[model samples]
Target: MTKFFNSAMAALLISSTSIFAQVENDTEKPNSNPPISIETMAGSRGVMYQLIINKKFQSIPLGFFSVTNAAATWEKEMTPDIMTQAHLTYTLFKGLDISSGMQYTPVYGFRSVAGLIYSYVSPQMLIIVNPKVDLADDLAAESLALIEYRPKINDKLNFYSRLQGMYGFIPKSGIHNRSYIMLRAGLGYKEFAFGAASNIDWYGPIKHNENNFGVFVSALLF
Candidate 1:
């Protein structure tokens, strides 16, 4: 009777060990499914004010300007004459991006603007290309090219200067060209930034004006 009981106990122990080994093997199996990609949320808001004084020496009027989420899908603002813009972007390579968007401004007399922009950012320089077409009553088109050089100032402050030129073609009118030089200074703390840019518009003939200044403050949130 003792031998029979010992044999039964041995068989029970072997069965339990087999079951444990099978569970371990199942847990160690490699998963063949790929990991899911996650999307990140980022947003920015800026408020700008411009004072324009023309060469005719007229009264200076305050121009309120604002651009919110300038790079995202549903970006819009009201300060710059009640303008709204929608953008879609695709990354072509590292540090380079291409974006296309449509802008509408009711205050500007129901005008639609379609534009393509390319931006390149590096440690020492920044470049932007913007080509736009006006798809409204007046068939007008414009292109702006800008280049900025980054200057290292400090940990919280930085300085840069840019040169931009704009050319416009209007129906029944000849080509119009304008060039501007801008100086920008930025102060950053955490996710908030304050920046000011001074613009000097140089109009080629036709009595173009000059000495226009704009200041802006921006905040970024994650």
Candidate 2:
């Protein structure tokens, strides 16, 4: 899996480089400020920090894109875990993108995967659907979804909430690999937000579960 993941990452990078070179002469200004979102959630369970990026290689085709989403967590009773997913995408149609990326977890180590992502994005609401399969041995499959809504309450504040979930399994044996659901709600002012948060995680085929509930503060940096 490690070897395959490295190869896939290299291939994607190389392909993207070539694509950018071909369009280097295009007469579009480069992006001045790439959008980046960062958040930190701490509770009775532990601390988790998340980073998300959606960037473009150029502006011509309007579909060339890159994404990096990652999270790291430290729990009181468990070993720290860091997971990352990155992929290059092209808009296949309205709100849909073909994705290929690397996924890392303590259980599976690293796996190269390919998948599709559908997104609905607006000022007040966001929805995403992502499903991918391992390109290496074991062929683990994973799916995830996230929904968020932040309606404007005034010029300086907004009501914020989000629900996110993910599940993974082995295709051949039909065994569950892992799953988790997380929820958050709060109020946002400028670049900071504070709210209540909860996380429920299940591990392995037996579905051993852990629960954490507490308050959280988060920040967004440009």
Report the error of model 1 at residue 94, Å. 6.3
For 86-126, candidate 2 gives per-residue lDDT tens digits of 78776787557788878788888878888887665556666
TM-score of each: 0.45, 0.76
lDDT of 1 by residue, 103-143 (tens): 55442343556665544444445455556666777665655
Q: Which candidate should be chosen as best, given lDDT against the real structure?
A: 2
lDDT of 1 at 213: 47
Q: Which residue runs does candidate 2 get wrong by more than 4 Å? A: 1-34, 59-77
Which residue pairs does candidate 2 place in steric collision? Answer: none
Model 2 TM: 0.76
Please count the clashing residue pairs in each candidate, in the order shown. 0, 0
Clashes of 2: 0
Cα lDDT of candidate 1 equals: 0.38
Error of 2 at 143 (Å): 0.8
